[model samples]
Target chain A: MRLAILGIGPVCALGSGIQSLRTGLQGKVRPNIEEKIIPTSHGEKMLPVYQPVAEGLDRFIPKRALRRVDPFTQIALLSTYLAIEDAGIAFNDKSRVGVVFGSGYGPTRTTFKFLDNIIDDGDIGASPTHFANSVHNAPASQVSIFLGLTGPCSTITCFEHTLSNVLVTAWDWLNQDVVDYVLVGLGDEYCDVLGFAAVGMNAGRTKDMQPMNFNACTFLPGEGHITFLIAKDKSHQEGYAKISEIRMRRDLEEVKASISNDPVIINASGNLQQGKSFLKVQQKQLKSYSNLYGGFPTSSAFDLAVGCVSMKDRKIYPVPESQKKEVKLENSIICLEFCREDEFNIYKLE
Target chain B: MSLELDLKKLIIEELKIEDVEPEDIGDEDALFGEGLGLDSLDAVELVVILKKHYKIDLEDMEKARAAFASIKALAAYIRENSEVQ
Candidate 1:
């Protein structure tokens, strides 16, 4: 089903909402982490961290509700609230609304706390509340609970492709008429021990590991939540962009063939002809925006945000690539592709 | 045991900095952009960590920013505001 983006909200190092984020993207500054906690011996040094801009939580969150949720959940709920508000949808009738959350790592603090208690004071020390909040689906569940959503609720954790995975899932939900509106998001919170441990375990396996452990230029642990409301009808508030299409492919050649047929190719490689000859037939603009956003899992969320803003501004901010100065946008034609392990590829054309 | 030393240890523990001990973090060192090396994100995360550890809530950014400047500063802030007598 075709879905229109009604509203968008994000908390990142770039700042909050669309405008600050737009400026951040255009500037292409690597987010600084500077988190104090470093290894006592042999571990990664933290660098640029993704922090949420402290807006008045009381403005959107109830005092009683905030008492029970973790900081990550609070960020997710706030962003979700902003999406609903931007969509101009009344929260009273939520039976028609669905929620989907994407996370590379779910609520690390909650999980960490639970583990700490279990190790320190035995299983009896584990708090039931913390245990409940530690699940992968807790973020999405919290959204439903806070918004009173009775519709379908789901969560997707596909490592780096989390946002894209959720996007595809949300697109399906909208197309099948499962729900008239859907709130989709991705949230990741930093856990110092977990972050270091992940890199330590995966160090030899992955090429793009966190840098030197202390610089934000590398993978410093970050916490951020971005929410979008998708509906059949266009949103009342100014929408940043809309989903053109979302497709997942198990084969790269199949994706290449499909991309060759698309009208726009926003390849991460900066080579427009990187797809296929069929796509190469046209004099389509080839550009990259990686330098702007500094490649992350939910970077697509930023890309989608950029696409939305580009639609509004009528200009595509070009990444520093080759002889190409910039990619101009006469109309809103954007294609997003995410590939993992060369075995799976997901393409979304909007 | 000085409360400031304990606070530094807690910061190191909560932030999961395995390399440093309470002695590494000076009582008057800057937490961000210098001495202790924390950013705005760490400041926010520290809010929850402090609440859990010391039972103190630092909500305002200005206050959080100031308290986070150094282990000593954070300890002083905690001592002044903590309800436990």
Candidate 2:
């Protein structure tokens, strides 16, 4: 599949867009913090969530449609616009380009609010406005509407593997000459219930978490939105990253066996089993980026953003807290696990 | 049988509290920390619930947060402030 990445935009806990992510990844900084408690019965008191600055976004998204879309969807819409602008693609281009998005906790928070209104008050009391925006496919739908695109609009809700799935699917469409371009997007947001349930669920298993399971904390309740513009035979100037090779598998052993040489594995968690397995394989040197990126399901999207930036700059950053280990940098492969059983994605960035 | 009982039932239903009936919820017990396990979001939902069911417009967030302590408290607050038609 010859899909060229024209531009990438990301809004996460760290900051807004690709530059914020790049700075975060490069500096080994941790951006997780407790925000104000939301008004919900859900357990999250001070939830760790990512919210983007509202500056410069109004120029990209329209006002009428913006009224309905939530922050996450708004971020998605903004990223799409930025990606199109970054790609130098004109909105007037009437080509049938599709938008494929991956979301881990798709519209759950919004749906939950609607559920509250329905269960608490009567159905008539439920906010028709909120109810309309609760669909899982809302981001893509809004993107389609924003661009007035009459093309294939798809949404994926497969935990963290969303980006790989969307990219591969988009790649397939491009490979088959089904579409000229695909706007691959990823978005996840924090709701009080989700954040509380996350900590509650984590506490149930790990019981004695003193250091507070930093990896899980980063993910359980953070909000992030990112988008990449992939074009066929359409390579354009200085600020672009190519989607080199995206592969997913059923288990981690396949990843271990598949990774050829010194690679950067952005393990979602600091799990010893997966960490040790990478060490045992001896395929190549492994540098961890998870500590900096945190542990969100779509966190790999952030790491992918970093990798894309690295390819453009020709540099590999060390693990955030590597402690002056004098680690050598090399052309690295990115490996990750979507879940315990599911072998995540391994991106070979050039 | 009373407005308080009715409010209690509505809270449990709204908050998705399983296994507990309206009669079981104590009037003076805490609704948030250590009592009914309701959090801030649930409190917001409760405020919306009251406004819709009882025509009580709880514009004050602080007062609503306090009312969410328990069914008894919420019922009293509702009785005092509700604009029932």
Using DockQ, give the best candidate's number: 2
Query: How would you encode candidate 2's per-residue C-alpha lDDT over A1-350 as one tens digit per residue?
Result: 44577788877666666666677766744565445454435543444444444345779754533545666678788778777776676745545688889988877778888898778766545755466668778989888887888778899988756777888888888888777778899877767666566555442233221111334323334566889887764444445456567777645567666666645656544443344444444443555565443445676777777767766666666555554333334664464544444445677665
lDDT tens digits by residue: candidate 1, B1-85 = 7787677776775555545677777778787886766656556557766666666756687888778777767777888998742
Q: Score the docking of each candidate (DockQ).
A: 0.03, 0.05
Q: Which candidate comes out best when scored by lDDT?
A: 2
> CA lDDT of B79 in candidate 1?
82
What's the CA error at residue A199 for candidate 2, in Å?
Answer: 1.4
Interface RMSD of 1: 12.5
Candidate 1's residue-wise lDDT over A1-350, tens digit each? Answer: 45678787766665566555667656644443334344535654543334566354577766654555768887788778766776676756678788998887788889998898668655445555677779889878988887678999999988766876788788778778888888998777777665565345332222222321222222334567788888764545355556656665445465455544333434242212223432322334434343343334555565566666666666666543333334456645545444543433343424
Second chain alone, TM-score for each candidate: 0.85, 0.85
Q: In angstroms, how far off is A127's CA in candidate 2?
A: 1.6
Model 1 CA RMSD to the hidden true structure, in angstroms:
11.7
Candidate 1 accuracy as TM-score: 0.65
